[model samples]
Target chain A: MSVLDKIYEKAKANPQKVAFPEAENEKMMQAAYETGKEGYIKPILVGDSTRIKELIAERGYEESVFEIIDIAEESYKNDVVARYVALPHTMLKEKAIGRRMENPLYYAMAMQAVGDADVTFAGIDNTTGDVLLAGQMIIGLKEGISTVSSIGLCDIPGFEGSEGQLLAVGDSAVCTNPTPEQLADIAISACDTVKGLLDWEPRCAMVCYSTLGSGQGELIDKVKEALAIANEKRPDLDIDGEFQLDAAIVPAVAAKKVNRESKVAGKANVLIWPDLNVGNTAVKLIQQFGHADAYGPMLQGFNSIVCDCSRGAPVSEIKGNVVISAVRAMGQK
Target chain B: MERKELEAQIIKMVAQCYNADEAKLSVDSVFGEDISGTSVMMVGLVSEIENELDAMIQLSDAAACKTIGDLVDKVEEEL
Candidate 1:
């Protein structure tokens, strides 16, 4: 099966409540409706109840398909806000938190934070900043990860790698220039995302400009430090790096350049780019030249599955991202 | 490393992150407004800076860094 097909299968098999805060946006609402109808997710529409109902009528979808959360309901808002203030370590006053809850973005994140939703899918009606800030201020970051990052799954038709034409690349959409610790966070997040969605063993490679000790510079040191930190942080996973793209993916190149034993050398399914400069450009090239379908840049390192989709993404692409988001939220606590 | 070198590295990173001109991004450049950055982008930059300095930056402290200079000062204090 194609990687997307596999992800679709997984999402269909285990449908989760993927909440849409931008339910007022017609395009996003329609995408959420279709996603629900297709059984890829049990989409929850979090917005004004009457408007949402009207949207459902206009869109001609069954209202029962989604569990709609009425953000306009004072009682529901009170309960969510009370819970937010009551959560340990929450220092924000009730009035302050209530003001934030008025925004659907924060309300949706609050749903996921309080266990009412499995995934908080946004960035359509909301800017990337609004989504990220809401997620941070409400759900907070995961333990040990200082910041959030993302991972993209590329399915190149002709080129077969460790996963048979599917390769996961990361930090392509976030973390412009990661330091060693942030790189480690990206690598760990990428590993978890791939393992969650694709069920792969996650042989991740820390991609760099050089292979092993073949070349040395400040850039190479950053990548080398990232690999060490990742290995130390998630000792259970197979993550090795300080290799060029060729050395990371091609067995012959790895054998020639990396003269030591490694688990992820050449046989890597996950490619963790050192910085966003390399990452963003590489993925664009893969899509343009390799003609690959790059699945995501799925946002990671949050306490919940908070996805950030492109603002200009079409309805179909938006639904695809929602399904991918739901599939990733499958095993999260 | 001198604070000047540290400040220069931060300017370089902020420039690269936001596609802003490095010369224009002073330590006073407000993160969201000045550099056209978002909360998400700032996290990576500050956390990376924290790691570089091996400084412990609390979440609240990180949130308080509105300008690049504020972040550098926080890092310096922690260092």
Candidate 2:
């Protein structure tokens, strides 16, 4: 089965509560309704209750099918603010708490923080910065993870390297120019995510213009440092790199280009790009030119499950993201 | 660590983050305006400080620190 299908099966076995902070968006509402109706997740929509009811009525979905959290409700607002304040070492001061309490994204994260919700999928009408800030401020990062990065699940059909078609390309949406340390974190997080989502051991390639010592530049230096750092930190991970794209994936090319014997040199399924420019461009190229099915820019490294949707995502994609988030939530539980 | 020692470390780390010499930075140097640090760079700096000091420096708290001195104070507070 496909990743989404496997995720759906797992989600069905363990239904998690997912909050949609952008309930005002029609796409988000539709996806929440569909996913809720299909029993993939228990949808909690954060918005105005009356308006959400109207939208649900218009969409021919029963209002009883999904639970709606009205942000304006005094009790709910107080609950979210209380949760935010309770978070240890929260830098959201008293003055900012009121303003943040007014935001649904914060409310969604607050719900996750306090265990009112299992996961949150947002970013329909918000920028990545806003989503990430809310996540950082409220849900916080997993222990030992200082940076939050993103991973894109690209399923390039007929791709030779991966056992399945799906490959995890990371730091594509967040971390525009990650330092070596941040790049290592991104790779480690992506590997953990693959292990969680795909239930397979991840072989990661730190993708760059150089393969081993074949090329030289500051960029290659950064990749080499990231590879070393990741290897040192996560000795169990099968990761190697400073590889050109061909050397990282194609075994024949890796054999010819890389002098050292390596496990992940050519057969890498997780490609950690050196920078966002390369990672983002490669994912889009795969989506358009390579005709791949791409699903994410999924935010990783948070203590709780939080995924960011592309603002332009359609209803189906939103529903798929909800499933992905549910699957992540299940894994965490 | 003593105040002077901590301040010296903060300045050195900030200068390293900015890819400049420690001589170029001071306790009064503002992080973004004076030292050319981006938000991403600040995150890295926070992680570096946490690792170096073996403390939890909250990102929000780190972001609130405008200058090298402020960062030192934050680190000291965490310590």
Best by DockQ: 2
Query: In model 2, which regions exceed 4 Å deviation?
Result: A93-99, B1-28, B32-79
Which of the numbered candidates is closest to the native, going by highest TM-score? 1
Tell me the deviation in Å of residue A141 in model 2. 2.5
| lDDT (Cα, 0-100) at A97 in candidate 2 | 57
Compared with the true structure, what per-residue lDDT tens digits does model 2 show for residues B1-79?
9999999987887777678678878888876677874454565576567556655575678888788898898888878
For each candidate, give its TM-score against the true structure: 0.82, 0.81
Given candidate 1, what's the lDDT at residue A198?
A: 81
Tens digit of per-residue lDDT, candidate 1, span B1-79: 6899878887887787567899888988886588764454554554445434556455467667788888778777877
- For candidate 2, lDDT tens digit of each residue in A252-324? 9889998888888778889999998998899889999879988887889888888888888888888888898
Interface RMSD (Å), every candidate: 10.5, 9.3
**Top lDDT prediction, candidate number:** 1
DockQ for candidate 1, C-alpha atoms: 0.06
Error of 2 at A79 (Å): 4.0
